[model samples]
Target: MKDRKYNTTEKQQTRKTIQRNVNSEKINSKENKANNEKVLDNKKILIISLVVVVTFITILIVTGVFDSGVQQNVTQMNTESQNSTVNMANMQEINNLENKIAANPEDMESTLHLAHLLQDSGLFEKAVTNYKNYLIKNPANADARVDMAICYYNLNDYNTAIAEMENALKYQPKHQIAHLNLGIVNLTARNMEASKEWFKKTVEIDPNSDAGKRAQELLTSH
Candidate 1:
């Protein structure tokens, strides 16, 4: 009986050892599966991040926003360069005309050209001087008289402007430009009635002329 009791105790100890081993195996398996799932989630997150970065880069390239901005800057620079070049050329031409007038004081063409250039450059006093010198040589030149009148008007000499314009009309009664210039001078002097009369005369003389069109526009505006 003693031997049988010892054998039974040994068998019970063996069974407990086997059960402990099985439980340890099940816990290890659960741990391994959880680790694998975490690794898969990390890989998916990495892939999504890479895709978003690539898509953003592609959108920037496809839209051409950066390229268009560069092109616009280049075009603006080119336009400024061209304008500078043209201004330099115009100044050189003005210098040449001035030299011509200085050497030959009797050069009517050079005087007229310089006067026009000075007027365009806003040098009203210099333009008036040249115009007056040209007029002294050919007093009956209605166009030159009108040009001088415009110069006088720019110089704020309202009376001189009006007199010169009226003198231009004396040379040619149907001088549309003279009439238009007279109207403009009178308007500047606040003589609305006189201005209207000159404008009316300009329209009646030549309805299809540019001066007539300007007169009509002024009449309608007033």
Candidate 2:
């Protein structure tokens, strides 16, 4: 009976030991599972943070590029608008000049005025046509010839401009404006020596004249 009781006690202790081990194992398993979940959560947070940072950087880059393009487009549009306004004003003035010419084709004064206006407005080709017509009516108008030479110079016809200026000098030997303009044209053509000579001639023509003052300035600059 004592042996049987000792065996039963040993069996009970063994079962108790087994139960303790199983409980400990279950607790360890739960802890390990919780730890794994925490690690996974940390990894997910890191991945989300990287994605947010990359997306923000990309947005900044795209926004900067868009702003620069918008600014350039705005500047170009303003420039075009300003140019259009100026062109409209020039066209109106040209239309008025044409109307006057149409009304009185034989009026040399109006014709010459239109030519001068056209020249001042940078319409060199039209100015040249009108100037040629004026010269046809008044062949010996040295001033008109000089004005035509200026149109030629503006048109980049340097040789023809020089020839026309020389013809003006033939008609009026001491024309101060013609001499000054010759100096200017030669200076533009990079003929420094000829420019100096013409400027000197301008000064000699009339020291107190506006043309003379301009010539003196050019000479001083050189």
TM-score of each: 0.65, 0.58
Off by more than 4 A, model 2: 1-87
How many angstroms is residue 151 displaced in model 2 relative to the true structure, after the best TM-score fit?
1.1
Report the poorest 10 consecutive residues by lDDT, candidate 2. Answer: 60-69
lDDT by residue (65-168, candidate 1, tens digit) is 77788998999999999988877877898899989888999999999888888888778898888988998998999988888888899889999999988998
RMSD (Cα, Å) of model 1: 6.6
Q: How close is candidate 1 to the true structure, as a TM-score?
A: 0.65
What lDDT tens digits, residue by residue, belong to model 2 across residues 1-222?
999999999999999999999999999999999999999999999999999999998997788976778888999999999988987887887788789889988888878988987887888999999999999999889999999999899889998999999999898988889899999999999999999999999999898989899999999999
The runs of at least 3 residues in candidate 1 whose Cα sits more than 4 Å from the true structure, single-residue gaps closed, are 1-83
Count clashing residue pairs in model 2: 0
Candidate 1, residue 172: CA error in Å? 1.7
